[model samples]
Target: MKRFHVHVVVPKLDESVRFYSSMFGANPTVLKDDYAKWMLEDPRVNFAISARGGEAGVNHLGFQVDSEEELTALREQVVAGSVEIQDQPGAQCCYAASDKYWTQDPAGVPWETYHTLGDIPLFGADSHEKTVAGASSACCAPAVSIPAVVQRKVGCG
Candidate 1:
């Protein structure tokens, strides 16, 4: 089965990890000083965090497979194109699962290829885990706050 992958670079790896852990109900399966990741199965996605160049958010995104057989097939396909396999499957990781691999597109963006036979618990989309509150900042500030009553009056009720 085909699945989506998204990698985001963040300023604070720990905050991002906590944010996603609360949002997705799964902690990073793999984490290090420079990187951390969540292999979430319910929605079939791989979320990656990286600390490089001081940049933050969405490094790349692609597909994640479901089995070793699937990974092998994709590895062959990737190798045939003369692309070196960055990370092979079966490598030890931190949180839920045990193995994963990494690949890259022609543009040099990284895409994670992995399978989590051991599933992790997931949260609903509307879970309080997510930070919907936009923070005040220089580049972008939060919009005017409205009371629940005003929200209801505006048909957002």
Candidate 2:
């Protein structure tokens, strides 16, 4: 079965962690200096927080698979279906050990599937820093532009 979770960005990692710990009545299972995540097993949801750009709120949310084999098979299925696979399996990312595949629907909403294997690389305190930076550098493209519009009064051009 696929596991679903949301990743929330936070301005203050420590503050968020403390608040969540109190609200949930349990400490986060995975805690790093720059990142913290609470695996609420009872509810089967993962709430994660990271201190990056001092921005708070949802990052990217999706399902977590159970094994590498599952992830690899999913990737193959996605590819065989001819739906573009955004990220192929075998890429190290997000402080999680596993293979993953990212796919987007026709409406442009993204979905991800992966299986966690073991500990993830710190990449210097903030794991997202390295991962996000590499993405921007390698996968990023120029933003598309839109034409500006001008409004006129009834009598004014």
Query: Highest lDDT among the candidates is held by which one?
Result: 2
lDDT tens per residue, model 2, 1-157: 6567667768888899899999888998888877778888777877777775533666556677787677777778767766665553444545665555555555444555767666656522232322322443111110111112223346756
Clashes of each: 3, 1
Candidate 1 is scored at a TM of 0.46
CA lDDT of 119 in candidate 2? Answer: 69
TM-score of 2: 0.66
How do the residues 1-157 of candidate 1 rate in per-residue lDDT, one tens digit apiece?
8678776768887787888899998878777775677767788777777665335656556566767888778777766766654443333332234245455555556555666555323211112211124322111111222111111223554
TM-score of each: 0.46, 0.66
lDDT of 2: 0.59
> Would you list the clashing residue pairs of candidate 1?
8-58, 9-56, 9-57
Model 2 segments beyond 4 Å from truth?
72-83, 105-109, 123-157
- RMSD value for candidate 1: 17.3
